[model samples]
Target: MTATNVETTRVVRTSWLPLIVVVLTQIQASFAVNALTVSMAGITTDLDTPATSVGTAITAGTFGMAAFILLGAKIGSRFGTRGVFQIAVVIHGLAMLGVALSVSPTMLFIAQASSGAVIALIAPALTVFIATNYHGEQQGKAIGLLAAAIPAAGVLALLLAGWFANTIGWRWSFVLMVGLALINLLLSFRLKRVPAQPGLSIDWAGAILAAIAVILLSFGFSGLATWGVVLATPQAPFEVLGISPAPILIIAGLIVGQAFFMWLRRRAHEGLPRIFDLRVLATGSERAVTACMATMLFVGTAANFLIPLYIQVVQGRSSIETSFAIIPYTLSIFLSSTFVAYLYGRFAPRVLATAGFVVVASALTLLAFTVRGEWSQAFVVAGLILLGLGQGAIVALVFNTLLSAAPKQLAGDVGAWRGLVHNLSGSVGIAVASAFAVGILASSIATSAAEHPEISDELIAQVNLDEVNFITNEALAELLATRASGPELDAAIAVNAEARLHALKISLLSLAAISLLAIVPATRMPRQRAGDLPEKLEPDDDDLIDPVDEQEALG
Candidate 1:
């Protein structure tokens, strides 16, 4: 076809229907996780399990996505993007149904895990569909919308799941997801079909290695609080000699991760099909973009986790209260994600990304000083709004840059790598934040107790300070009720309150420091405007050459 014909074909094929379908698919995946978070109290009450069980379920879901996302991308190419997406959506809905019907913590953990694994299939296909169906600016806007769906779903889950848990039950939240999944599956028919590359071979060995590495890292970080950060605790299931299994698993994960990369280089040398496309990260700019993406996600996810912990645990507030308190932040993220595309043509990626990190650092510093006792304070609200704006812009900008850097044929790999980084970084962010905050809190409590004249060292010996976590003043009083009375009880509660607040402030400041450090990577992002990037491959051109064959020829 002539250039004019290709232009005409592109316009004719571009429809908002595909964007809507993919965005809804993203919303479905995001809503499931958010709903679980919002329904934590109800799930704990109904299942008669500790809150940590729900946390385990969340970690399990993260592990599932991180471990299988690379493989999921390969699966999408071997079959067809649309077909695999449809099947995955159906399976995810079934997993949600299982979540709704779960009677025990184990059931909930398995169901959420299944949902996450299936999302690995859906995530990559969303990017491939946009690449196949849109061009130029339209493609940029589509990616922004895709990024927006995440916080939009969070807002929806907070409102809907909170209301459902309060009135009917938490189960209704996932039931609603099942209904939406059905609608999304119906809408899947409208998406453009990308032909399957049946000749593409699966690298089962690399897939296993990647899966093992992700699982080890996820589990190791997640278990730090329970299994002990450096040494074995009484709660640890097993220990290596006297050391905690957590650190051992983390070290092993790093070794295996290095091996996975070496194996990929070998595959490239031999001209064999690999699990992921290394070309996506071949350039310095591309590597910098990846760093920027991971840093933004780590800071954003950590802030998100810390705020809720403070709201619900420190202040002894309800889920509904916590949800409403975060509305400004979530809404700001939605607005920024949707409108940031307009600025892409005016500014280079490096400029936008650097500015974004600076804003985030400033917001975190403000939050560290402003947050005292309440979530409704004006300064806290301002900080959250600022944080959301910076985070939303960076998330959208890096994604657009990474996608634009690669050929349309490698979109699946780009999408896969993005998914892996998003989940893994978020998991580590929460883990580190939890461990750091609790460690500080524990140390503060011990020092305060030692200094207080009313408390005795013998009393401290009776209680295990190492097992302490973030809890409300009321819960702390109940725990010490039998051991101490009158001024002693009062002093312990006072110590707990002051220590928790101090720990929170320190944590926010530390996160702010990390955000400031991220500016270095943002400065190295691509210097070109989005419009200056190469035009997207035409639809007919996409089907003409296989990505595997193209890689071999390029080598």
Candidate 2:
């Protein structure tokens, strides 16, 4: 090729490099932070905290993230992506450092919640970068690569976190995060500055309301296990499978808050943006995004949340053993996401998406039925693969669809909404699944206890709590090992097995139903190949505004 032609191609290709770095760094940070879940016990032990309290700290981080996601978008829009990206990275670094240095549970919670705020800022800006710099197949591939990196990084991080925690403690885990944020900060410099477009105004009220609604919704959903129902009733008006109303009200309130926000957006002025640009959600493709997010959460939660419970409680596996068992699910997501991105252009998205959901639903249904005493690792691995494949396809496809469907300038908005929905669904899925499983297990325990009066109080005490039921499975098995020789031990083991099987079945059924719901939205995904959309509809200079150069704005 002529030098002139070669140089032109290089320029075009190089334009995407900055965005690529941003995506990679974002994934790295996400993976590192989330890896903490696997080591939550370690964190609580080091800090002298209760497990439930530690979970609350983690949930606070999530609420903070959901609360500020839109604000991050607006910040990115005002300040160039470059500036917002840089600031977010710095804050994230500081937050990690703070967490590492924290001596008390209160400090740790504060630091983690603060870190969530920075994540909200950085995540949206990074996503917007992909939308603006790339178009067509390139854009789809970019989004896919970014999405794929998350699970891959997560698997890698989880594998290493155990060793890291063993060697230096959980505090050191955040130290690693600090280093990652620094790397992200350095790489962020190469990103092109999004020039500020005049006439853009922040909708303060809309942003606040949006943040409040999401925070309330997430809080309410997360509390489902503890609170049971949302409303106070005379006769358990909102009982689910015999559970009572305080928890469900949170879900109801979130729905109502969203409706009010929609009303606000409809009446708001043109220049100011509503929390969610309802117009974006009005599209068929957007429906695909919503479905994809919810589906991924459903599948991922079923695998991540329940498998650990099943293994630790029912199968009596250790955390390290459970993590290894889950490797296939994580790795499958990485592999499938990578493959699907390349294939998205070659095959119809609807076909791939539909097939993906089917795979997930099938695997989950099998899990419901096959969960028995002495199950093979092979069966679990196979199920994990199907789950991963389904989620990988959905995540990659949704990222591509949502960002592409959104206006370029609003990439941050799209990214925030996407993250919010995905994480929220995941949180809700786990909560609901846990509650369902517990309800079933509780019923089993009650029935079995009535029939097996000889069961020791010590054994019954261990069975009452979910954590004890999970981590002490082998211990429980040992306690009942003599059952092979006597009726007393035999009865106890039988009851334990029955309770576990019931829990597993209930959780799996819920997952299967959620995966089916995914089918409805996946069918609405855009059918065209990349680059088919009009250039005017894509992100351009008019969509963004450079942040006012104020020193105070620096995080």
TM-score of 2: 0.81
Write down the worst ten-residue block by lDDT for model 1: 533-542
Task: Please list the residue runs of candidate 1 whose C-alpha ends up more than 4 Å from where it truly belongs after superposition.
Answer: 1-12, 48-53, 529-555
lDDT of 1 by residue, 504-555 (tens): 9999999999989988878777644234222222122124323323232222
Best by lDDT: 1
Candidate 2 regions exceeding 4 Å error are 1-20, 44-58, 98-109, 132-137, 229-252, 268-272, 312-319, 371-376, 405-412, 456-498, 532-555
| Clashing residue pairs for model 1 | none
TM-score of each: 0.92, 0.81
lDDT of 2: 0.65
Question: lDDT at 77 for candidate 2?
Answer: 64
Q: In candidate 2, what are the lDDT values of residues 107-189, reduced to their tens digit? A: 88788778877777777766667655776667666666777778867786667665565566767767887888777777777
